[model samples]
Target: MSADQKHFSPPARLLHWLMAPLVVAMLFIGVGMVATLSSWHQTLLAIHKPLGIAILGLVSVRFIVRLTHRTPPLPNDMPRWQQHIAHLSHWVFYALLFAMPLVGWSMLSAGGFPIHLFGPVNLPPIVPQDVQLYALLRSAHTVLALLLFATFLAHLGAALFHGLIRRDGVFSSMAKGRD
Candidate 1:
């Protein structure tokens, strides 16, 4: 890899940092929506739907950026197994990022609920309403969400390992961007 490819492009870095907190917030807000029975439930739902859609949109752009840009390579000293795991984990992240929102949207669609973005804005249904389909989609969403959380934790651990323990430039490639 060339020296110029050692760090992510500015837009890629911007999107990564921008989406990180939002994704974390979405996870917590999802939990809050499920746990609460009061008015907060509705409020959380209100935030959740739009946020999911926003994530979907951003990830789409991010994916395009990923396809076009040259990603930094793993350090030469890193083990082959570590390199494989890193690549696998990234694909998993992409899958979860794209799937989660689509699943949620499909779940709502199956439940015959209009996705109110904000105010009068609403998204049209993506699937025909069916109770069985709704149940299936809901279950899928929950399971995938758990997987997403687990993968996120793994990703975090790996980032910390690179950033702190290894003191490698891998973390900085994304965290600090090109200098």
Candidate 2:
């Protein structure tokens, strides 16, 4: 493969694809958790907590993989501003990926809620419970979730721009390896 066309390592690609749907689902679940007053609220909460934790774990590994590996470079013909935006957006994504789950977890901790990962797999609280603290963390979590969704949309738009308009390999680099 050409250097610019080099695909992400399999593991990185796997993590990227895996996290995409998961993050989307978590966003929807968060909305559902807040919107519903029925028994389904608890049901959504059950899914949201564990999923956030899972995202946390996967993002940790993804961060490490990102640090240790080399990603394919953007097309040389792309504008410098676009390249800068691409790099900045990537870091923003990484930050959001790490921050969203943490804020959610801490929000629960501050509210004295158990972060039950699964059947009997409860994570310990990172902060002591306080109503005031819970309010702040909960607000932060909601704002960050909104920010994450915006970033996701921007990333998707860029991917489509590259894949469709530019016909560049940028999208395909993560989509698949050179054929």
Candidate 3:
């Protein structure tokens, strides 16, 4: 591909930037939810539920964007193993992006909690209510969330390695739409 053509599509870049902050916010919100039982806990819950759903919807669209568009290739001088890792990391990101919300939704459903987005709108339960199932799913959600946070940090570090250290176009392909 031509150097310029190596960049991601405009829509893909936009979605990437947009979701970055939202995902970070969701992680912090989750931490807040667990770290306190104060009155603010409820406020956090109200925000978290809807935000998770929003991420779910956006990720569905993002997945389609990813599949339909060609991503910028890694630097030719980069190691084959690194390229494999990079490709694996992206699929992990997609899997976690889809999993986090679905697991949250299923956990809540098992706990018999409402999936309120706003106003009177509520999502129907995906799994039947069972205390044991709720406990298992809740544990799974926490573990997956921790994994997500670690993955996000790894991605940021990789981006900086490409942008600052390697002087590679990989970061710019997403950050500025050119390498």
List where candidate 3 sits over 4 angstroms from the true fold: none
Output candidate 2 Cα RMSD.
Answer: 1.3
Q: What lDDT, from 0 to 1, does candidate 1 have? A: 0.93
lDDT of 1 by residue, 89-132 (tens): 98999999999999999999999998999989999999999999
Off by over 4 Å in 1: none
Provide the overall lDDT of each model, using Cα atoms, as 2-decimal numbers: 0.93, 0.91, 0.92
Candidate 1: count the clashes: 0
Runs in model 2 lying further than 4 Å from the true structure: 1-5
Evaluated against the true structure, the overall lDDT of model 2 is 0.91
Cα-based lDDT at residue 112, candidate 3: 98
Better of 2 and 3 by lDDT: 3
